[model samples]
Target: MSFINYSSREINCKIVYYGPGLCGKTTNLQYIYNKTSSEAKGKMISLATETERTLFFDFLPLSMGDIHGFKTRFHLYTVPGQVFYDASRKLILKGVDGVVFVADSQIERMEANLESLDNLRENLEEHGFDLDKLPYVVQYNKQDLPNAAPIEELKNLLNPTNVPDYPAIATTGEGVFQTLKAVAKLVLLELKKKR
Candidate 1:
C-alpha cells in the first residue's frame, strides 16, 4: 500500500526484494544505495547477524524524481532469505505495494530457488494477496556465475505467470535499477487507478 502525505505532498510506497538465502537480495539493495545520490535518499538501516546474514530487513528510502504534482518516494526492503526466517519475511511483507522476486540462477541452487518461491506463494496467501494480482517482477541474478542455468529454464520454472523478468548480475549493478523502476512504475500506476 502507498501512503499519501498531504503535508509533504509525497507518495510513499514500499517495494520488497525477496529470494532464497544468498540470492543477491542484499546486493540489489547495496547497488541502489551506492548508485543513488545522497540527496535523493535517506539512511539505509540493516539488521543482520555478525556473519552478515539479514536477521530482519534492510530499509532504504529513496526519492525517485517526481510524477505529476506528487514526489514519489520508494521504501525499499529486503527480507531475510534463510528458511528459518520465514516468520520475519511474512512480517516484512505487510503492506508491500510491489515485489521483486530475485532468483539465484546458478544451476546448483535450483532446489533452493523452488523452495523459496513456494514459500513466497504461501506467505503471500497468509497476507491475503494473490501472487498474480500483486505487482510483481522477477530478477534472475548471478548470471555471471559459471554453470548458471539458461534464462529460458529459469523462466519456465520460476515464472509461470510470465511477469516482467530481467537477467541481472546484481553484484555489478546490471539490471538493478531497471527492475526497481519497472516495479515502482507499476506501483505508481496502480495508485493512479485508485484515484
Candidate 2:
C-alpha cells in the first residue's frame, strides 16, 4: 500500500526488514542511517524496552530520487524478532510495500532462519499479502563470520523462488546498499504499475 501525497509531491512506501532475533535486521537499518547523507534521510528512532536491553522496533525514513516527478520516500522498519513479540511483528507488517529478510549466515542459525521465514509468510498472509506476489528480497547477513553457512546452501533453503538475494556483512555496510537498492527498485516499479 503505497501512499501518494499529492500536496507534497511525494510517494511514500514502507519496507520492513525482518529476520530472527539478532539476525542483523536492525544492523542493516543502522548502517544505512549512518552512511546515508543527512539530506537523504530523516530521524532514526529505536524503541527499546525498560531494561534498555530489549529492542522493540527500529524506524528510519529515507528519500530516494524522484520518479515521474514524484519524490519517492521509503520508511524502513524492523520488527522485534523475539518469539514473544510475534504480535508486534504482525502489526509492523501491515501495509508493507516491500520486505527484506535478513537471514543470519551462521550454520547453526539455519533453523531459526527457516522458522522466521515461515512466520513471515503466515503473518503476511494474515494481512492479505502473498509472499510470492510481494516485492521481496533476501539478505544473508554476517557473511564475514568464520562460521557462516555456504551461500549456496542458504540460497537453497531461503530463496527457493529465486528472489533477488544479496550476501552482506551489515555491520561493515558491505552489500547493504545493494540489498536495499534491489528491493527499492522493485517497490518503485510496482508503484509505477499501480499508477
Candidate 3:
C-alpha cells in the first residue's frame, strides 16, 4: 500500500519495526534517526510511556533515493512492543510495505520473541497480508550481551522461513542499518514488481 503523492512526486512506503517488549525496536529507529543526515530525513516523532517503552510507534520519514521521477520515501515505524499494545500494533500494521522483526537475543527472552512472532503473523493475517508474502526481515538484537543466544539457535527458533536476517546490537548501532537496508531493498523490489 505505498502512497504516491502526485503533487510532490514522492512515493511513501511504510516499514514497521516489530518485536517483543524491550527488544530494541525503538533503539534501531533512534539510531537511524540520529545517524541520518537532516536533509535526507524528516522529523522523527516517538511516543513512549514513563518507563521509556514505546507507547505507540516511532515515525521517521526517510528519503532513500529516486525511482523514475518520483522520490522514494520510507516512513519507518516501530509498533509498541508491550503485549497490552496489541490493538495499537494492529492499527500501525494496516498499510505496511515491509517489516523488520527485532528479536531480543538474550536467552531469557526467547519465549517472548516466539510469542511476538506468532502475534505478528496473526495480526498480519487479520489485515489480509500474509507474512510469507510480505517483505520481511529479522534482526537478532542485543547480540553484544554475553547471555545472548547463539546465532544458530536464534536462527532455528526465529527464522525458520529463512528470510533475510541479521545479528545486531542496536545500542551501538551494529547491523542496524544493514537490517534496515535489507528490508528497504526488499520493499523497493516489491514495488518494482507491482509496477
Candidate 4:
C-alpha cells in the first residue's frame, strides 16, 4: 500500500520480508535498523511474543537516496513464520509491493524452505498476485553456518528462476544491504512501471 504525503510529494511503498520459521527474517531487519543512519530511518517496532517470536509483525520505515526528486520511503515488514501463524502471514502479505524471501541454507532445512515458498505463492495468489510477476528477491540467509548448503545447490533448488539472490549472514550484516538494495531497486522499478 502507498500513502501520498501531499505536503511532501512523496509516495511510500511497503516491502515485506517473508520466509519460514527461524530463517533470520527478523535478524535481517535488525541489521538494517542498526546500520541505517538515524536521520534516515524510523524506530524499529516489533509486535511479538514473550519468546521473541513474531506474533504479528515487525516494522521499520526507511528512506533511500532521492529518486527523481521524491525521497523514496519504504515500510518494511516481517511475517510470523510458524506454521500455526498462517493467518498472520496472509494478513501481512496484503498491500505488499515487493518481497524478500529469506531462505535457511542448511541442508536439512531444504524441505522447510520449499514449503514456505509454496505457502508464499498460495498466499500471494489469494491476494490476486502471481509470485513470478511480483517484485521479488531471494536471500540465502545464514550462509555463515557450516551445515548450510552450497550456494550452487541452494540456487538450483530454491532459485532456479534466477531472481536476484544474495548470500547473507544476517547477524553480522554481510550481504544484508545487497539484499535490501536488490529488492528496493525492483520495487522502485515496479512503481516506475505503474507511472
Report every candidate's CA lDDT: 0.94, 0.93, 0.96, 0.92
When superposed on Cα atoms, how far off is each prediction in RMSD?
A: 0.8, 1.2, 0.9, 1.0
**Model 1, span 81-176: residue lDDT tens:** 999999899999999999999999999998999999899889989999888888899999999999899999999999999999999999899999
Q: For candidate 3, what's the RMSD?
A: 0.9
Candidates sorted by lDDT, descending order? 3, 1, 2, 4
Compose the digit string of candidate 3's lDDT tens values, residues 82-163. 9999999999999999999999999999999999999999999999999999999999999999999999999999999999
Error of 4 at 111 (Å): 0.8
Q: After superposing candidate 1, which stretches have Cα over 4 Å from the reference?
A: none
Worst 10-residue lDDT window, candidate 4: 1-10
Q: Which numbered prediction scores highest in lDDT against the true structure? A: 3
After the best TM-score superposition of candidate 4, give how far the Cα of residue 85 lies from its true spot, in angstroms: 0.2
Worst 10 residues of 2 by lDDT: 48-57
* Model 3 global lDDT (CA atoms, 0 to 1): 0.96
Query: Per model, how many backbone clashes are there?
Result: 0, 0, 0, 0
Displacement of residue 86 (Cα, Å) in model 2 is 0.1
Expressed as tens digits, the lDDT of each residue in 43-120 for candidate 4 is 999999999999999999999877667788999999998889999999999989999999999999999999999999
